[model samples]
Structures are given as structure tokens and as C-alpha cells.
Target: MFDVPLMKKNGSLFAGIALLLGAFAGNARAEEMSLQQAVEIALQNNAELQAFRDEKGLREAGRIRAGLLPNPSLEVSLESGALTGNSGENAFSVGVSQEFLLAGKREKRVALAQKELEVYRWQLTDRERLLRLDAKSRFYQVLLAVRKLKLTEGAIELNRHLYQVAKERLAAGDIPELELNLVQVELARSEGARSAALEGLLASRAELSLLLGGKEVEPALPTGSLEAGGAVKQAQAELLRLAQERRPDLMALRAEAEKGSAELSLAKAEGIPNLTAGLGLKRDTTAVEVAGLEGKDTSYTVGLTLSMPIPLFDKNQPGLRESSARRDSAGNRLAAAASRVEREVAAAYASLSNAEQVLSLYFRNIMPQMEENLKLTREAYQLGEVPVLTVFEEQKKYLEVNQGYLDALYQRQLALFKLEAAAAVELTGGVQ
Candidate 1:
């Protein structure tokens, strides 16, 4: 897959303004779109994928041209005068000649061209697949930014309410001025966080817009569940195997090397001789006058001429050397591609494993514990057995856990994307 580098934070802010335009319109217009439909639109319209499709057409054209034989040439010669018994006479003769290729050059070229076309076809397919996955990844990032915005917004509102309560308590001499200041500080922090999240959401939407190759994408997120299809452990081996079979970039490199090999062979074969043979009918005024020779009665001449290029100064020596070097270079690139793919797949699996474990922990232990602790602390504070400060601390911890849960969920989904990219296969059946 082609690399989509991470956006620099400060630089991203300016770039993302266009991303928030739709959201602004949505706020003003109350219209938004679902994520799945957005992904479908992106896949259908992404400019990069469309460009690759154009490239595929060129490769196919090359294949068609390669299958054709060399065109024959017509030759003409004229003698101004032919002396017969001191009589001035002139005759012109015309013939056609064609050179047959030696050492199966045409077939080899067609084979190489066919391979090139196949290589391009796979590259196009791979790009389409990556574009779809990229759109989804960007979608999740936008959602995460929105989700974080909501959390911060909630936190700010709660802190503002608590600050008012503390103000009342201080007025009644129930709490110190320092406690009210602390609540005000918390409220300020929450508001700052909300602004930061809003900025991130804007930037994320812009990045997503670039991926979609358009400005029509919106920030309203879909809330449906992502079904994790197969067990993570089972999918690991499956991904590795599929990558070996289906990694198109690697296959393209191999095809390129094979094409170079064929070029080298063609260069070596260039020194070989080819048969230039032709058949022709000839008619002259003298022949017509002497023997009543007409078009059909003209005598036929058939012969073969052997032609070859000498190994003097330039006997395809440079071409062979260049082709051989390129073939070797392509072979090295293929080797590197295989190594990189292996590492990429392994790293993706490791990340998937760790992310799954993290999500499981958040789901089975941390969130439940945080929720239970918050419930008990709320009860205690209501009974006046514990101070409201303890209940507030639990409340903060519960919110943090909720944020962590969202982080785990998005991280796992991103890991799944990476794994499929490395493997170059739909190991999860289809992306959600």
C-alpha cells in the first residue's frame, strides 16, 4: 500500500478548515451523512484510484501492441536505361520484403507485456482496497475526535455546575474560598480540553476530506457496532498465508524483474540472423512485346535473403548490460519487498493482539470497577458518611475510564486496518 503520512499538528489546523465546512453547514442546515455511505462514495470517486485505472489502460494497450509482428516494407528500384544492341530502354521493378524475427522475440515480448498488464491490474486492485480501508480509518478518527469533544463538553458542564455549588457553599461558610478556586480551575481545564478536541475534530475531518478527494464529507458519525468477525488468534495465521499469496506490490516487482530478463534475452538474440523472404511477379514492356506477357502471365520470382547486424562497434552489448543490471536491481527490490511485507504483517498482528487485550481489560475489568466505585462513592456522599470531594474524585476516574474505553475501541479498529494492509487480503471477510 502507498504510504499516507501522519499530518503535523500545527500545520494540520490550517489544512483542516475545509473539513469543518461541512460540519458548519450541518450546524446551519441540519443535514449529515452516515459513515458507510461516505466510504462507498470515497471508493467510487477517489482521484488516486481513478489515476491508477488510467495507468491500467496504458498497460493493456502495451500488451495489444506487443502481440503484433513487425510490419513488412515495399521496395522499389528503377534503371534509367538498359542497352540492348545499342538501344536505349528503361525498366522499373518493385517488390516487397519482410524480415522474420529470430529466437522467438515477438512471443517473448508479448509474454513480458502480458505480465506487465497483470502487474498493473493488481496494483489498481490493491489501491482500491487500500483506499476503502483508508476511508474507514479516517472515519473512525473523526468519530473519535467527536467522541472526545462530547466527553470534554460533558466534563466542562459538570465542572461549571460544581463550581456554582462550591460558590454557594463558600457563601454559606460551608466550604473554604480555596475549594471554590479549585472548582473554577477544574472548570477552566475542562473548557480548554473541549476546545482542543474541537480543533482535533476539525483537523481530522480535513484529513478525511483529502482521502475522499472531495469537500462533501460531514462530521456526523454513525453509532452502529463494528462486528469483529473471526477470532484474533485464528486470523493471524490466515493473514500471513494470504499475504504470501496476494501481495500485489511484491508480485509487480517480480513481474518487472521477469520483464527485464526477457529484455536481456531479446538483446542477446539481436545478433542472430533473420530470413527476409518474399515472392513477386514481374512484367516488362520487352517481355510483353516479345511473349505477350500480361499481368497474370508474368513470371514469378521467389527467394530468401538472410540479414544480420555485425558485432562491430555496437552489437547490443550495452543493451544486454543495462537489461541485466536492471533485472538484478528488480530482483533485489523483490527480495526487499518480501522482507518488508513479513515484518509489516508481524507487527500488525502484535499490535492487534495487544489492542484486543487492552479492549478486553477495559470491557471486563476497568470500566466495571470504575462504575462500581463511583456508585458506592455517590451513595456514601449522599449519606454524609464521606465528603463530596471523594465522590468527585471517583467521578473523574470514571470519566477517564470511559475515555480509555473509547481509545481501546478505536485502537483495535486501526490495528485491524494495518493487519489487512500488510496481508493484502480480506482476512476479516469484509471491512465494516
Candidate 2:
């Protein structure tokens, strides 16, 4: 005869072993990382961000080049009359000349380069801002997956415990085979759900690893929650003001507009032709015949010369026109960017407001009531005052309600992230 109590104990032991094995297999090499740590890692290691940082060197080089003086040119010439049988009659000259930039062209070029560097700096900051937002979003997704996996594990345990109860009752002839069969079915379903949840967790972890620039042999486990932070009491007007002052992309555009102005000044300066000044030493040797006497005469002279372009037809008209057009275009772009910032701030604020209300409703009403109902239903089931189907239905309801609550939490957190990114300001504390 099969001993029901011994068989039940063995089944419980086997289930425990299987769960432990599954856990070990899933997280064999997992390393726990916090949300802040993940964001830091991404900022430090992201290939694209590093590439943007390298561009600062090029901008700095341009600034250096703008401040440099042109190299002086050296000229040497010799003239001989050897073909005319007068080798002694020769002339040689050596000269050096430097073309000096006029009308503050060099200063304006340096200013333009500096403005360009400022623009690049702001652009790099904007990239970092966006990268932080992406990392936070991906981290929250991993956290949500972790929560689901735990929820499924809890459900499995609950169903397994009830399965044992049903089995004991069946052995004592206190319940029908149909009731035991129903508990068995619920247990199996919970186990299957756990498998799916685990897969979801793995997928989320893989995505996070890629973002963090990690070639992880096993995915890093995220350590964070989707709990709501303090409420954002600031109005949309305040947020928009903050965005105008803090948004890096907006600042980048402003810098670019300033750069265009500097370029226009440079183009106007360039219309003034540079002056090239030269100093030279000349030596002349001539054979003279006076009163039938042959003699040599040598003379040396030093001369200074200045030269410049006529600027008759090309007074940099094309350059000036291009610079003026660019300046106007930059101004228009800045205005358009400001309008877009207003729109983004308004949209993010609306989403955050809606998410906060939904999350509050779940916390203040649905979650507590669902927990209480589930507790009562389980008690009634154990006391034989309710059918297994009633317990099963209540358990399913608890899972569904909790899942909905988790979704609410995730949405609320995501909305908060988007709001912060749009505003380019931290409204509340970091992720909870």
C-alpha cells in the first residue's frame, strides 16, 4: 500500500529541489547592481558617448589654429649675364615677407572657434542627459521584470501549499478527487507562469547589460524598486522655466547661434585684404670701362616693400552672404527649439499627473481590498466553508490585481523619468 503522508513529503522535497535548481541555473553568475551604479557604468563606458567626448580635442585644435600667425616667406633670386659674355655683371637679392591679418580677422576667427567649442560641449552634455534617461528607463524595466518573477514565485508557493492541504484531505476521505485534481491544476498553472516570468527577467537583464556596455556572461541583476517617489508639486510654468534654463540641447542651439554671429563678424573682417610687408638686401656687381681701364663696381642696398590685394571684384561678398543667412537660420532654429521645449514640458507634465492619480487610486483602494479578500477566501477554504474553486478564483484575482498594481507603479515611474528628462531638472529624489 502507498503511504500517502510519505509520498506527500517526497513530492514537497522534489519540488523544493527543482525550484532551487532553476534558480541556480538562471542566476549562476549574476552580479547585483543598483540603478545609480548602472547609470554611471553606462555614462562611463558607452562607445558613442566616448566618441562625442573625443570631438572636443578637434575643436580645441581649431581654436589653437585660429590664434596662430602665418609663417613668413623667404625669397632669394640671382641674375647673371653669362650668355652675353658678361659673367661679372650679376645681381642677387634675398627677402622675407609676412602677410599680417587686418581688420581683426584673427580675433574674430578665434572667437568663432571658441563659440564652436562651446556648442560642442553643450552637445556632449545633451548626449549624456539622454543616455542617463535611457539607462534609468531600462533599469526600471528590469526592476519590473524582477517583481513579476517574485510574484509568480509566490503564487506557485501558495498553490503548492494548498495542493498539500487538498492531498491530506483526500487521504483522510474528507474531500473528493475532483477537489484534489483542481488544486493540482492550479499548481501546474502557477509553475508554468513562473517559467514565463523567469524568461522575461532574463530578457530584461540582457537589454540592460547591452545598455551598460557590458558583455556579461550572465546578466547583472538590477537592485531597485518601482515605488513612487515624492509628488511633483511644481506647476508647468515652473517646469518650463527650469527647462529653458537647464536643457542642454537648448543651450547647444543658443551656442550655435552665437557661433553664427561670430562667423558673420569674421566674414566681414575677411573682406579687408591682408597687408604683406617685406624687407630685402640686394647686391649688384658690374664691370666698368672708363678711360680704357677695366674695373669692378659692387653696391649693396636694403629695401622695404608693402603689398595688398586690390579687392576689386571679390570683397568676400559670397562669404558675407553665407554668414548672414546662417545667422538668420540659427535664430529661427533657436525660436523653434524653444517652442518645442514648451510642448515637451507640457506633454510630460500631463503624463506624470495622470500616472500619479492612477497609482494613488491603486495604493489607496484596490490593493488593500484585494489583499483582505484573498486572505478571507483562503481562510474559508481551509475551514471547509468554501469550495476549492472559490479559493482558486480568489487567488487568480489577487494575482491579477497585484499585476495591475505593479503596472501602475511602472507607468508612474516611467512618467516621472520622462518628466525629468523633458524638464532637464530633477524634480524629486532619485529612483525609489
Best candidate according to TM-score: 2
CA lDDT of every candidate: 0.69, 0.82
- Assess candidate 1 and give its lDDT: 0.69
Minimal lDDT window, size 10, model 1: 1-10
Looking at model 1, the pairs that clash are none
lDDT of 1 by residue, 1-432 (tens): 100111123233323433454446564332344566767878777888777777867887898898888788887766533455412344456777787887887887788788778767667766766786788788788767766766676677667666776677678877678877877887888888888988887788778777776655444433323333355544566777778777777767877888788878777876565667764444343332346633222333444455555557767778789889988998999899888888889999999889889988877778767767866775664444666577568768877877877787788888887887788765546521
Best by lDDT: 2
**TM-score, each model?**
0.76, 0.86
Worst 10 residues of 2 by lDDT: 1-10
How much is 223 displaced in model 1, in angstroms? 4.5
Candidate 2 residue spans exceeding 4 A from truth: 1-31, 172-182, 215-220, 290-294, 376-394, 429-432
